[model samples]
Target chain A: MSTTTEAPQVKETTKTVDFKTIIDIKDMDLYYGTYHALKKVNLTIPEKAVTAFIGPSGCGKSTLLRTLNRMNDMIPNTRIEGLVDIAGTDIYSNEVDVETLRKKVGMVFQQANPFPKSIYDNVAYGPRLHGIKNKAQLDEIVEQSLKQAALWNEVKDFLKRSAFSLSGGQQQRLCIARALAVNPEILLMDEATSALDPISTLKIEELTQELKNKYTIVMVTHNMHQAARISDQTVFFLNGEVVEFDQTDKLFSNPSDKRTEDYITGRFG
Target chain B: MNNLFQDANRQQISGRRRNDLIWRILFLGATLFGIVALSALIITIVTDGIARLNPDLFTNYPSRRASASGMKSAIVGSLYMLCLMAPISFVLGVGAAIYLEEYAPKNRFTRLIQLNISTLAGVPSIVYGILGLAIFVRTFGLERSLLSGALTMTLLVLPIIIVASQEAIRAVPRARRDASFALGATKWQTVSRSVLPSAISAIMTGVILALSRAIGETAPLIIIGAATYVAFLPESLFDTFTVMPIQIYNWIARPQEAFQDLAASGIIVLMIMLVIMNVAAIMLRNKYQKNI
Candidate 1:
């Protein structure tokens, strides 16, 4: 598809070789009342790789990301058609409890919305929701989740401190730890670091790199460079349609679609 | 002309300052008007009733002799009624708020119900008294006992607590609920653990204010037949009761000047009870806010 232009750069992406598909979305269409938000979308996400969805504002990348965990169901009058099969089961089916689905597919929001609680309680909130009430077990999960989110060192000493006491960056990471505390199979991040400063963004990107080794990560980002730096696969979306989905370096260096090239190169979004 | 703020007309600025001073004084006067009125009332009551503030006020029952009469029965009865009415109103009101805010879907029916509740909060307390008369006193055969009067007071204040609780619950940021729900907490869990905890202090403040209004109420209890000159304290829910307001009202109606002075002493007692309730609520609010 990039027949005319010579490829400029290729970052090594050798790890995508053994990726096993864990999420298969087919013929998926999402509608909010009268307006169709996502149309005829098909995607297969690897089990333990960071797949970033990149698009302009209102381009349905975030909409698609929300559909992955049915977070969009919170919106009234929303409808979904076709299949979103996670680990070989349709998440939208009647038998699938929405709460359990959310527990398994944890999410971190754009704004770091930690509960008005202690740092330990914010992390332990998830485990307690699933009925893990033993103090020792909760303490261990809190420690492990905070460590996984790279926030243990900053907050471990003051575990009883209010979550709002943390700086914005630390709070965002605390939210990440909160999501990870549930021990989810997939972590959906909807512009999770966009609210933070550049240094915090880098920290979250680095955290994502380490986190993808264990959990399948789906992230929606307005920052193309963030997608390039952290994602193994990049899905470029335009007007609710998948314009191009490919390995991150391949798409950035030599996009098959002209629109993808324009958006990535900052010619126009 | 080069400086965009060129020559701001010093004379005009001075004139504006004079006008601003007038408005400032006006607002200050408006604020002081309320304080002055209240202070004058307290001064009058204190000067009139200071002699009645002796140990005799606590121990003596109502008597034909003005100096010997005390509010012992009224105080005990009022306290007992508050203790009875408070729990019932709090549970019903807060429960109604939780249902409307968390569980009930927003629809025309719920909007109508909410509208009615708001209107009920503004309706005269006398109307609630009448309702209590027809229902609790007559239909239920409870008569004009403390239970009937307490239930009427509950009815009078229930709308207030519900409205205030709804406001408190609504004031909680939606993000907090979202945070809880995202962690796989059920709707009830989210509301109880997250939403309620954040709103409890504000809700308590509202409850205290509502109860304060209930405590000062005279007409509802009067309509429910609170005996104005009870010699013995109310012993049970079904026992005849007379509250402080009714006691004070009865004294004020007497032609005797000493009885009027006694009424002022009763007024002081009522005000003290109110101040205590408000102070306790503020302390609880501060404690809870700092606890988090």
Candidate 2:
């Protein structure tokens, strides 16, 4: 069901906007040692929307996601140039605390990487780190986040059980709950559901939809169908460059670039 | 064609015969050598030492006369030395290992430290003895006391402890660290809360094995001047000490036939202690392996 039509250019209009841009990345370049992983890239992520980055492996989708939270700073010989501003503050600025920036910008990995701890402890870890000491407060957050993840029912009885003892799908949802418990304004997910079965993937996709009402989400996924099914805005990346970015409907049904069209149709990676 | 076929068959038969004969000889020779060596050592020790084994060996203190003597003093002294040495060595070694494995950046200095530790592990026991004599005994004024010997032995096996502990800590999968960090824990928090607990058994195994090695060391204690004929048990860390190996050495060095018997008995005791330590290490290692 391919449809090719030019996106209608908007006429000049003026209105008062209430929402703010949560993340503003401009001219961002990332290098692993001497290899340029992400060429100069730029994007503005709006608040409270599911923004999906779709690309083949090694195209720098994950790199861009990591840079949003300064997670790449952990790797030795990894260097970034250009600006990544979150909430009007440059995350790369010398005065900004990396831990505080990370606290506000939570991340989930490709694999379900729950800590080798109790489910309750795993969910409570983030809040505890940011100096939440009240037992009642942490308990409330853990229960609320788990419920939001649609995992509270399955795991509530076994809250004290090890996170590792959960099923793969359960573990992934637990990780999501953990990220949510911290109350981050922006959530960065790097192929969060790529390792789960289709049923679990659907659950996470649904949860992502529910979460976007409160938190802005930027996810990297290789699955085109997943991007189309879950995301509001889709950015198609190829060879460390943004090939096409539009509404999900437009990007999938009426891709403007030949490369995006080919990738979407499974003609080539 | 007939000639070629015959020649091929003959060569094949000869090669097969040679191969079979060589394989048979090698297998039989290895088995025979292993059995002979093990039996000879066991029989020699048991036959010579079994006569000295008695209840008093564990109950009474050492004496000048063989008929009145027991290994109680040496046993107590060895236990006390282990008590002091194990904790000291474990703390120093594990701390060094954690710094090297988790925090220390890869640089020329760390590389040099790592290399030096490996080389030190290979240094002869006697050299450690001399160093202990010159340093702990003289400079520290420990005066050939149990503390001096323990300190010397600690240095002797410190490298082994560090190496083993490093391996254990490194064995903890990187995913654990990533998980902890993603949860917003700091580096030390990640290590102490997650990595160290998972690696505890492996670290313990290393510590116990090193301690076992230290317990059996005779040269260092002898060089540090452990007394041979102490009638009283050591009352303090500064008191002169004699370990099982040193006592056994003293016994074996005597011309009296009875003293040689005492040496054999001491060998049995030392062997039993070593076996117990090794078994504990193996158990700890297995427990962690199952969990991880």
Candidate 3:
């Protein structure tokens, strides 16, 4: 089979990859010092599906997304309460090694932050960190990842070129390729395309449709249309609380909560 | 409706413009003051030393007779002291910077340490000479050898390198660390592979500038007893030595008119080294700026 995963293979891969609840969160609360960032949050993310967290600014959407991979641990005085289980294990437990946890759950940021390195090196960085020293193995992983991220065709000739040479959109895809080279089961995107132009945002949206066939994707987006367009499930948050959660079409077409409806239909956010 | 194009307060507008020009001229004068002073100094040194720049000045050791005296030992001493001091200062300075910036908790203790480092960077160089006296010279019993002198120079430059390194490290975008950690890299791995590489050029630029300062330093070495009239080269780190600045100081202090000329020649050599280092720093930054 070609290294580039095609959309037609989604059904076959879903059966093998266990398209079930990969993430289980219950009564989760996050506090940045005295300020409560995420309160009484409960969410379950299934494997091999796209879940988008949508809300206005400072509504705890990004905070909730960060809790999945524990990236919020980087902040000072960030305290967490309640259970966050991923793949049937409490990620915040003392026994869980954060490095290994992050390897399984990759992340891409709002900015397309490629290292000041050659494109090939950026893609191979993750695998190298996990001790993949064999040159041939790294080459194959880099090739497959770049292909999967839809960046291989444009960059195949100059893998030696610095990643900064790529355009903003291409650099974002390179970051995705870097994330995928480690073979992560879950991918977290924190406003990953908010920095891009319309065309670039559309390209990332299309790439997400193709990516959910293999990896569980959790995204935080300010654009409600983006949630409706790409996500299988949509979550709407308001002021550190989850106001509504439903299937994408159902939530956009007919939200159960008045606040969600008001926010979605050009009402006060 | 009010007129859109014409301005009403003609006098006020011209008055504001005049103040702007006045400020600009004042700033220009301030800048020219620095430039004029530096050019005058350089011109004086070049004229005084240009004739003394012969091969013998670099080839022979100091002699009692002004005509025969050369700067071989002092020149070699400064170079060797730099070689010894550079690595020691680099590791200690950058290590402390990394620890403070990356790993240290934002507590009162770390804040105190940060304040101390800032204060040390401003302390008089002669004070560092006193520190070297009590610590390296007397307590350690290292004596006034090349090693002691090097250790003293390291102390003098450590604060500068550390502050510069810290600033460089802080300037590394938070995005770089986020990208690394999201890939499951450990703290050491992320710092070594991503953050350090991004900050390397800036840190190196700072380190080179600090070393240039250390090279021209005289008061500290004098207080630490760097030797004079040294006719022999050091065989090892523990041997007695004298640097160019010390040699030049002794030369200028002498009553003979000829020694002043030799001092000018020594200043020329020292200035050349500093210029080369600063240029190297700029080149290093330009080379790495494009990569990021």
* Candidate with maximal DockQ: 3
List lDDT for all candidates, in order: 0.92, 0.87, 0.92
Question: What TM value does model 1 have?
Answer: 0.95
lDDT of 2 by residue, A1-269 (tens): 22353332221011103335788888888899999988878887778888999988988888888888777878889988898888888889998887777778888888998876789988998898778989999999999999988999999999988888899999999988988888888888999998999899999998998998899999999998989988878998888887778778888999999999999999988
CA deviation > 4 Å runs, candidate 2: A1-19, A131-138, B1-36, B289-292
Scanning candidate 2 chain A in windows of ten residues, the lowest lDDT window is A8-17
**DockQ comparisons of all candidates to the true complex:** 0.69, 0.39, 0.76
| Selected candidate, larger lDDT, 2 vs 3 | 3
Q: What is the descending DockQ order?
A: 3, 1, 2
lDDT of 2 by residue, B170-273 (tens): 98888677666766678887888778988889899989999999999989888989897777789988998788988898889999999888888899999989
* Candidate 1 ranges with C-alpha deviation above 4 Å: A1-14, B1-8
Scored against the true structure, residue A201 in model 3 reaches a CA lDDT of 93
- Expressed as tens digits, the lDDT of each residue in B1-292 for candidate 1 is 6586786787999999999999999999999999999999999999998878887887889998997899999999889989998899999999999999988888999999999999999999999989999999999999989999999999999999999999999999988887888778888999988999999999999999999999999998888788998999887789998989999999999999999999999899899999999999999899989977
lDDT of 1 by residue, A1-269 (tens): 23454442221234467688999999999999999989999988998999999998999999998887787888889999999999999999988998898899999999999888899999999999999999999999999999999999998899999998999999999999999999999999999998999999999999998999899999999998899988999999999988889889899999999999999999987
Query: Residues B1-292, candidate 3, lDDT per residue (tens digit)?
Result: 3686476898998999999999999999999999999999999988988888899999989998988989999999999998999999999999999999999999999999999999999999999999998999999999989999999999999999999999999999999998999999999999999989999999999999999999999998888888987999999988999999999999999999888989999899988988999999999999999776
How high a TM-score does candidate 2 get? Answer: 0.88
Q: Who wins the TM-score comparison? A: 1
Poorest lDDT segment (10 consecutive residues) of candidate 2 chain B: B1-10
